[model samples]
Every structure is written in structure tokens, then in C-alpha cells.
Target: MEVIQVKNLSKNYGALQAVDRVSFAVPEGSVFGMLGPNGAGKTTTIECIIGLQKRSGGEVTVLGLDPAISRKELYGSIGVQLQETVYQDKAKVFELCQLFSSMYPDPLDYKLLLERFGLEAKTRTYLRNLSGGERQKVAIVLALIANPRLVVLDELTTGLDPQSRREMWAYIKELQAEGRTIFMTTHYMEEAAHLCDQVCIIDEGRIVALDTVDGVIENAGMDTMISFETQDEIGMVLEKLPGVNRVEQEHEQVRLYSQKEDVLTDLILLLREHAVEYRKINISRPGLEDAFLQLTGKEWKEKVS
Candidate 1:
């Protein structure tokens, strides 16, 4: 069953079309990810889907009801954590949690959630006194307090430390085990690769690619990358070798991309034949970021930075 369905969804801000004819579905009991560079319409698409923003065109259904028309009805079944949330500076953690819990008929134990998130000691802490990561944790706790059937997270682990991020991942997996659908937007390719069953890549307000993790990598047709630092200028010589698709050279660094399985062996033999000394050699298979680069023609790191 699809917990969320979007068809030709478009959102505009005056003359700017933020989301352009985007379409996708979120299956029940699965994690679905929306990935794209900043200003790629990911947040706008999410807003339209959840009825937080009015879409200029297209349709969206969440839990079989139109979000724009039945937002109140859908609220009971959906929990949302936005990228940015504003809170009263003087508000206490426990007070806010209690307020949110009151909105739901049967909410989860906010006290237990505070303990689970390691915020028990800060239950009476003022919202303004908490660190960015701690505040993010509070947002997550409130999102899940409803015991919602569907959870929507925007940049879910943005402010978390490595340990907290992994802990949150485990918690999300637990939510899935309970048959809750998860729809998320994230800039982290590794996070999407690790948690999402399906991912949609959007660029410039349009859908560029959508597939399973491995499927996207395979379909991108990106070659394996080999990088090394060497004093010898062997780029021209290596480019002529069979199985070497391309070679890039910069001062003492060289990079080779190839689709051939024997490219590594070929490189070794060529280097030995010419007695070209090399160091810091490394080889890597194409991953989610590579696929993003292949389809968008933009480096993931550069995009995020």
C-alpha cells in the first residue's frame, strides 16, 4: 500500500516555480527518501505534499485523503519534523512535549521519549538554553510522540553527532519494524543509501532520477574511480591503455575512471612496464554520490557546500 502519492505536483512562489511536476509514491512500512542539492525544490515539494504550502498545480494524497482538503484529518496519522522549527525561548522541554501530546488522542509517553533521547536531565531546561543538537532531539521526540502511522523528517539528523545520528537511524529502523511509513528529505547520500528503500533525486525543481539504491548506481553507468599521487606524469600514457575510460591529472595527482573489471590490473602492469613510481593509490566503486554526480553533473560535496 502507498501511504503517500503525488502526481505532477507543482508549487510556485510568484514568478518562481519551486517544484515542477514532481511525482512519486511512499509505500507503507518502507523508508522513502527525497534527495537533491539545496534550492532543488526538495523542501517545496515536501511542503506541498504535507499541505504546509499551497501547490499551484497537481495532486497529493496522504493516507488516502487529499492533504490540501483534509489536512486536519491527516494530521492525526502523520508526524512531521521540519528543517527549522521555532519555539518559545522560555519554554521548558517537558512543557512543550506535554503541549504537543495533548493534540493527539493517544500519544506516546513524552517522558520516556526524553529518556530515550538522553534529554531526561534537560526536561526542565529552557528551550533557549539547549544546544543545537539537543533542540533537534526535542523536535524528533515531539514528531514521534503522536505515535503516528507516517513520519516525515526533513534533514532528520542535521545537528546530531555521529553517535546520536547512528542511534537515530536505529530508532527509525525500529519505527519501520512497527509498520510505520517514513518519508524523509536529506542531503546525506550515505544516510539515504543506508535507510531508504527507494529514493528520488530532484534537481532544479524536476525529478532527475528515482530508483532503489543499487538500481540508481547501476543505471548511472558511472565507472569505478582510481586515484593516486605520483611524481611521474603518466596520465597521457595511461589514457591510451585499454580499459581506461578517462584520466585526469593535476600536478602530482592522477585519477583514472574505467568500466573494465581488469582496469586495476592494467594500470599496475602499465606502471611497472614504464617503471613509474606511484604512491597513495586508491580505488573505489561508484556509490550514491557518484550517481547524483552522473545525473546532475554536479559534485555532491560542492552542491552541499
Candidate 2:
């Protein structure tokens, strides 16, 4: 089932077009990743879908309800955790959890949430005393506490430590197992690559690419990097090989880069035909970041920085 649907969605800030004619759908019980670089209209699109801001134009239906007209009903089914969340500096973790839980009907157990988040010890800690990662954990706990059918998480693991991030990913997978739909936004391509069933890449207020992680990666036309060590100087022979774009040789090693689908097979055959003995051969496929860069025409690091 399509839990979320958007068509011709547009949002504008005066003369500035924040989001332009964006469209996509999120299936039920799936992690839908909405990815874009800074100021790429991702945040604006999110706000519109969640009914936090009025959209300039479009059609949006989440869980069979229009967010504008059925906001109260929508809120009951969706749990939202914004990119930046703050609480009373003096508020205890338990207190904040208790407060949000009270707002929902038949909320999840706060004690279980604390245990699941490895935050039992910090239950008494004040919001001001918690580390950035700890504060993120608290926000996650509150968002999921309602046990809502749909969870919208922005920058879900932004400030988490390595271990904590992994833990949170595992928990999200568990939620998916329980048939909860997740709509998440993040700059972390690796996280989105691993967890998202469908990835939507937006840039400059438009939908640039939307597909499965593998599909997007393939659509980006990024090359696979193949590198190996060889004592022989066969650069001249390899250079003429099909699908070989560029080859760099450093001492006894040669790094080959190609975008051909059958580059690996061709490379191995060429090496055997030339009687080349290679060691430490490795092939690196294009990752989600590369795909994002290709779609947005922006360097991931530059966009984030």
C-alpha cells in the first residue's frame, strides 16, 4: 500500500522557489529515504508533507488523509522528530518521555524505551547535561514512544556515536519488521543506502532521481574502480582495452577505472591473455554518495560542509 503520495508538490518563499513540482510515493512498512544536499528543497518538502508549512502547490496524501484538512487525524498516526529538537534545559529525561507519552493513546512503555535506548542511567539526567548524542537519543525515544503507524525522522542519526548509530539502525529495522512505515531525511548516504527500501534524491527544488539504492547507483553512471599490483609495465596493452577509461600506475600497482557493466570480466580476460600476474586485485563499486553527487551535480562534502 502507498502510505504517502505526492504529486506536483511545490513550495515557494516569495520569489525563491524552495520546492518545485516534486512527486513520489512511500510504500507501507518501508523506509523511504528523502535525500538532498543543503538548501536543495528537501527540508521545505518535508515541512509541506508534514503540514508544518503551507505548500505553494501540489497534491499530498499521507495515510489516506490530506495533511492540511486532516492534520489532527494525521498527527495521531504519525510520529515526527525534527532535525533540530530542543527541550526544557532543566527537564529530566524521564519527565520529557512521560510528557510526550501522555499526549498519545496507549503509548509504548517509557521504561522499555529507556532500556532499549541504553538510557536508563540517564533517566535522571537533565536535558542540559546530556551530550549531543544523548539528546538525539531522547528525541528518538519520544518520537517512537507513541508507537504511531508512521514515523517521520529528519536527520535520524546525525549526532549519534558510532555504536549508538548502529544500535539505532537496528532498532529502526525492528520497527520496519513490525510493519511501521518510516519516512526519513538524512545526508548520511551510507545510512540511507543500508536502510532505505526506496531512495528519492532531490536537488534545487526538483526531483532529480528516485529509485532503489542499487538502481540510483546504476543510473548515476559512476565507474567501478579496479586496482591491482603487478610488476610488469603493461600499461600500453591495457590502455587499448575496451571499457578502460583511464589507468594510473604508481610503482608496481595499476589502478583501473571504468563504467562498463562487464569491465571486470574484460579486465580478467585481458590480464590472462597478456600473461600478467597480478596481486591484491580489488574492485570498488559506486556508492550512494557517488549517485547523489551525479544526480545533484554537487560534491557531498561540499554540500554538507
Residue-wise lDDT of candidate 2 within 1-305, one digit each (tens)? 99999999999899999999999999999999988887888778888898998888999999999897888888877888898777898999999999998998888999998888789999999999998778887887888888888999888777666677777789889889989999998878888888999999888898888999999999888888999999999888887889888998998989888888798888889999989999999989999988877777788862332
lDDT of each: 0.89, 0.87
Highest lDDT against the true fold, candidate: 1
Give the TM-score (vs. native) of candidate 2. Answer: 0.92
lDDT of 1 at 279: 92
In candidate 1, what are the lDDT values of residues 1-305, reduced to their tens digit?
A: 99999999998888998999998999999999999998999889888888988889998999999999998888988999998775787999999999999999999999999998889999999999998778888988899898999999988776567777787788888889989999999888888999999999999999988999988998899899999989998888999989888999999999999988798998999999999999999999999998999999998963332
Structure candidate 2, residue pairs in collision: none
How many pairs of residues collide in model 1?
A: 0
lDDT of 1 at 198: 97
